[model samples]
Target: MNSLFHDRVRGLNQAPLRPHAQYVLYWSQMNRRVSGNHALAHAISLANSLKLPLLVYEALTCTYRQANRRLHTFILEGVPETAKRLAALGAGYVFYLRARKSDSNNTLYRLAENAAALITDDYPTFIAAQHNSSVPAKLSIPYLAVDSSCVIPMNRFEKREYAAYTIRPKVHRLLPEYLKPWDMPVLRQRWNLPLPAFHTEVTAGNIDALVASCEIDHSVAPSLTFRGGALEAEKRLAVFLDRNLRRYSTDRNHPAAHATSNLSPYLHFGMISALDVALAVERHGLENNLSSAEFLEEMIVRRELAFNFARYAGRQTECLSSLPDWARRTLLAHATDERKPCYSREQFERALTHDDIWNATQKELLLRGKMHGYYRMYWGKKIIEWSPTCQDALETMIYLHDKYALDGRDPNTYTGILWCFGLHDRPWGERSIFGQIRFMSYDGMKRKTDSAAYLREIAWLESTGCEPHPLQ
Candidate 1:
């Protein structure tokens, strides 16, 4: 058999194997599902080459910064389902470790004990990358980090890309080779290694079960409307492909239309892979359609561009200070303009103050765990205008996004917030409250879109009582 091992860097690379090793270990992090998983395929191939079984271990540690209820619940939902899927494929074992001081240590030691070679998911911005980088140094076994998240592995673009237009062609050139569907490897032989008797200190519970037990911040609760899991992701994708995709080109900008794919939360949680979604869209044979192309552009090109930025850009969380010099200069020049009315971060978060449309957008983000793309841009730009300083605007924007949006704290969120400061955007004629940074206003939104329709949609969500944050 051809050697199953291949060198791939998603966010980080897998470690070189030692001479004496046992079974292959997959330390699950970002990529959670069994289906259409490149990292899982790589690990399976390594195990086959080594003539050993494969073990998948996931640790739900609470120590990581911003380990909130929303993130925890989304991750927990996939564990048991993944465990069952692994068993069906005749993989060695699936272990889920919940957050507990004793359990966290025990799970780490257990993986180190059984693992001959370790493979983990590569994520750049969040705690996952920190763990992947730190854990390998402590272990005697070799660790490999696989790049499974992006359509094109992030390292392929050595530097931060300028825009989607620049990176789109580059990714298209490589897609023919990398975009082929991954086939599940048939496990030819089963090793009869004795199952370890060490008890899993972490409890294997559902999202609700785990959330109730967590000591993390509950101020921002799970959205009743948005539930995370592979099954739910697949259903949402199907609905989008079948319905919204046809009008996506023309209607995606209109928040009231419900024409865009709502699969972002699923994508953020790693419940569904981009390749899986792409293949389904291709199978639909809608490529000739303009709307289909537009949808794919957002999914494959724009979304991956966000990933490319987070991967290559240092200090992903730092605001306009980290942007390119041209962007920074333009923003600072316009920073001191007088505003008609400025709102505080507290007013924004509570969905208070004026502009019913903006307030509606905030409420939607809070209740639905998402905001319409059109409103999202307007939402961020308004923050730049309203805050006392551009820096404060950036900080407040990141805070609200990370706190409420399901797809918040993602590369897209980072890039989207930076967009207000002119990153990936050209300088405009200088103006107060915005200077040369691209400006988006409530009035401009009204001129460009059906404002009443958008407002009505928000009213409908309010009537349904879908609250994103807890009552203050």
Candidate 2:
């Protein structure tokens, strides 16, 4: 077996380099928190090995594609708190660069110059992958990518998994070795490198000021309810474990019940590690309990399966053409099926559709930056049915999801969208619009749970708080 450091870390595929750079640099992109972070732990190990300090740097640039109210606010919530935590860890430096139109490139270059080695969060989908691929080519130092997001790291699986069942046994087989708690590494010695003073403090207080000053789209303002940060992420986890987790197996499907762990935003932003959550759930004595086991299956096995898909399969964003041959053929046969009320992408986005339940799910996603897990599948499948073509529906789903959902653009999002096109899912009875693709509808949703209660909760959310808007 390859060394964990060699196989898991990026830029190690190259030859050994001369030791000239000062500190180990962790370019904070995805995993943003200090606790239970494998990437940070690995960086500390490398830093200690080199007898150097660890410098953790993060950049909040406005140039990312479709970066709007939901994305910006969710990311900003974790920044200042993360900086403070890293400072407490005796890190050589923790700096956050606010990228206005003029300064994005300068920030990256500045950090790259002072670092011995660069380590960043390993994310397959979205612009982060682009950054990971480009930075190593341009830099003189070694660049390492760490997998801190999934409980079973994406690299653990070699190929695109066929389904959750195919991957579940593999993940369970290795859980004893990897799922154990990671010991927090204590910094052995502090390097006397000069700390770079930050020019601006981008905490929650200055979020509005920062957003107002920027050139970003003003249409999709931040949701007042779902602010991102480590503290809030921890709080939500506690609430889930204390209240909802025991009932998760039964209550999770009910959209009205707040039984689901609302940790996606934190997971998306890297505010909390998946291992941390799993450890907490285990420590809560849910290991022997059936409900706990079921919950863990979804959280660990199914979730990591999504990560495996994105890491191995490059076509996670394309239309039906990107799906497995079985899926593509099935969808093609349903291309011209008659529909009662097909809607365009714009119609779906504006919540102008005829179905109240579908519109309610959209409204929920818009207002809360998330949706109930069960409803999310139904939500995507309906979009596939309503759009003019399978390709159009796939594009529309990815666009809306990546733009608004807090967990959008992650492996799970792509996998969930792909599930609509029959990836990681079994074929159901033949249907019209969906063909062999899994079909979900108002009728199926109603049979599954209390549709009326879900509708009432969504209506309440829409009327009481911040208005839902598309990320322009």
Candidate 3:
């Protein structure tokens, strides 16, 4: 096998470097955190090799699909901490905010003019995937996209995985080799260049105004439950280790138990690295005479499975055409099956359904920007159950996630959404609209989880705009 460094680095363009360049550019397109970042470290190595300083560029534009207040606020919340960290590391930080449709889109090209080589996150989904493909062709210097998104480099998998079981053994075998901490680079040459004119200073106090100034949709508010940043990610990890890890094996499915770490938004935004979280869980488990098996499984195995799927799925990641053969056949076999009380996309979006628990799940997505994993399963299954057609259900799930979820447009988000339509899942017993695709019922959810407690908790959040069990 190749070295992890080599495995992670993929050359996008073959152009030679600019000899008189002032710095090496590191673009934080996906893995936005400063520490435990392989892409950033790789950039540092290149900078040190070239005897040049490093400059990190990040941006939030108004052009992405569903660029709303919720997504904007979560990303901007992490910017201040990122700026502070990069400053301490002696690297130049440029955060370009293209808040309006007419705002300059050439900040990257302009930044590239001063750099020897450019490095960016080798992410598979969303805008990063698009950039990694199109941006390199336009650049004159060598472009490298590095895989910091997965602990084991995503390129190691030759083909897309069918299920968790198929990928688990391979992942475990590679874990010992790659699942260790990364040492971030100490800059040899400090950045001395004057800040670019487009550099938008982002502070907590100004985040609201900045977001408000954006030409994106203003209706969808920021997440009611989660905060975004490296500091916030660390806090959630600390809370999980102290209060949740012990019970995670047994109580994670119980939503009100709060046994799971609420780090999905942070992870999705690259505010925290999986390596750091995994190491912390392992250390805490060893010290406390407890097991972190379940947490590790979910964090590394299941999480990376989603990444692997997205890495291969490409533009069809959100479509029904991506489902497996069995899933397709099963759903097709029952296409004409009768429907009962089908709902429209607006109804699903508004959480207007007869089932209180399902409504609560949608409400959580509406208000909190996420829902407990167990309830999320029920939420998708019921959407499949109630929507006018399977296609409509798939569209509704994708639309809602893209519009509302802080973690949406991520590999995990797409995989989880597709999983509802039986992608990466086996067919179950024949059923009505679902046919052989897996079916979830309210009774099954209630039996397996603390649905009442979850319902009450969600209701409390709705009524008071305050969580009964606050993450703090």
Candidate 3 regions exceeding 4 Å error are: 1-4
Return the TM-score for candidate 1, rounded to 2 decimals.
Answer: 0.90
The digit string of per-residue lDDT tens for model 1 on 1-472 reads 2222243533233445656666788877777788877778888877888877787766666665566787677667666677677778877665554555454455666756757778788777676757776777777666778777777677677777888779989888877766667676866446456556542323354457667676677777777567677877888888877777777878888877778778888787678998888878766745645345677788888888888888777575455666877888776776677765788889989988677888888888877778889888888887777788888888898788777777877788888888778877787887776767787777789888887987876776678765332210
TM-score winner among the candidates? 3
User: What tens-digit string does per-residue lDDT give for candidate 2 at 192-308?
Assistant: 667666535677788777766655666786764677889988988888877788888788888677778878878888888888898888878455453568678888998888888
User: What is the TM-score (0 to 1) of candidate 3?
Assistant: 0.98
RMSD of each: 3.8, 3.3, 1.4
Q: Lowest-lDDT window of 10 residues in candidate 2?
A: 463-472
The deviation in Å at residue 134 for candidate 3 is 0.7
The CA lDDT of each predicted structure is: 0.73, 0.77, 0.90
Error of 3 at 187 (Å): 0.9
Q: Which 10 residues in a row give candidate 1 its minimum summed lDDT?
A: 2-11
Per-residue C-alpha lDDT of model 3 across residues 1-472, encoded as one tens digit per residue: 1244898999999999999999999999998899888888999888988999999999999999999999999999999999999989999999999999998989999999989999999999989999999999999999999998888889999899999999999999999988776577678999999989999999999999999999999999888888888999999999999998999999999988998998898899999998889999998999999998899999999999999999888988878888998888888887888778888898889989999999999999999998889888889999888887888888888899999998888899889988988987887888888888888988888888889988998899899988887783
